[model samples]
Target: MRNLEQVLAHAENHCENNGSRLTIKRKQVLTGLLISDKALSAYELIDFCKGEFGETLQPMSMYRILDFLNNQDLVHKLNLANKYVACEYINCNHEHLVSQFLICVECQSVKEINISKTVMTELQRNVLQVGFHLVRPQLEMNCICDACITSQA
Candidate 1:
């Protein structure tokens, strides 16, 4: 529960304030992601739950749960890979600048990193100058991880 304690508590608090609740199924879906080695697509998560826990949840059900978690910032979606990863900064109460993702193309591993404030500021300025509002900007880069690179060599 090292990763889930803070997340579940924050979710409970947020739901309490919003008149919603984090159901058991939702929590289970989140737990799947928390223990995953790589970002998981909706179908992959469905398979994981069934294989790991003998529970079969419909794809639609998982999708809805994912959407809610995403809205709560408890998870992040990698558009390039069409997968989701649990947010690494959920325990931090303080605000974060920009979040960047480094995804291993070969093994599908994902690492979330925060962009420097200076760079984020300049990037925001550029976007604003172009008259496009950047909402929750996430940069995803595709690369081979060290393990994969080493294994290849």
Candidate 2:
């Protein structure tokens, strides 16, 4: 878990660097996502916002906030689960792009790994050889972690 105030401050810096404004609603939604270790669906986020902000927010408003956060690379949407999680690292300089994720099946924890330059180049070459163009390259793999395995035994 992260300090909510620190998360907000970091988010504010991110917005300033990107020349975007972190509106109150966006901050609320982002902070809620940050505090959660697991991914949350849109509806869950709406409920969190209502509980925190004391006002019912529309689905459209939530979607807009999500879209903005995604575009700015502040949050990631897991296609498999149809949920969202705040980026593990917030100060990344790279353009907002899809990322590969490793999910621990037992704990439901997620880790993002950057696509190495060599791997990306090789993938592009192989795809071109097959007369295919790659669009989104995020790969989600399920595996058991050491702690889970040990605890299970």
Candidate 3:
């Protein structure tokens, strides 16, 4: 679990680095995400914001916040689950990339892992050999985790 204060400070620094201001609403949305362990959908986030601010947030507002978070690399969209997970490396300086996620279909748990550099290089080489350029790779696979398998057994 991440320290909420640290996460907020990191978010502020990130905004500063990008010449942006971290607005109150954005901070609330980000704080909500940082405090939760599970990935949340936009609707879930909206509900969270409503409960936090004592006012309902429009879907458009939630989308705008999500878009900002995504662009800032503070959160990642899980295409398989149609949800968003806060990136674990909020303080890291490396540029984010589209990567593979190991998803447990039974328990709905997700783990994100980067593609090996060698594998990416090989893929690029193979695609070039085939007279094609790889733009974005969407790789999501369903599998069972150890805990899930043990629970089922």
Model 1 TM-score on a 0 to 1 scale: 0.89
Model 3 CA RMSD to the hidden true structure, in angstroms: 2.3
Worst 10 residues of 2 by lDDT: 90-99
For model 1, residues 24-139, the per-residue Cα lDDT tens digits are: 77777788888888999999999988997888999888899999988877789999999999888876767766789999999999999999989999999999999999987899
Candidates' TM-scores? 0.89, 0.81, 0.84
Residue pairs with colliding backbones in model 3 are none
The per-prediction CA RMSD against the true structure, in angstroms, equals 2.0, 2.6, 2.3
Candidate 2 TM-score over all chains jointly: 0.81
For candidate 3, give the lDDT.
0.80
lDDT of 2 by residue, 20-138 (tens): 98998998899888888777888999999888888578999899999999877788888877788888777555564446787777876677777777787888899999999987677
Model 1 misplaced regions, further than 4 Å: 1-10, 17-19
Q: Identify the superior model by TM-score, candidate 1 or candidate 3.
A: 1
Error of 1 at 153 (Å): 1.1
lDDT of 3 at 2: 70
Model 3: lowest-lDDT 10 consecutive positions: 91-100
lDDT string for model 3 (47-127, tens) is: 898888875878999889888988787877888788887777786677765577787888766777888878878888998
Error of 3 at 85 (Å): 0.5
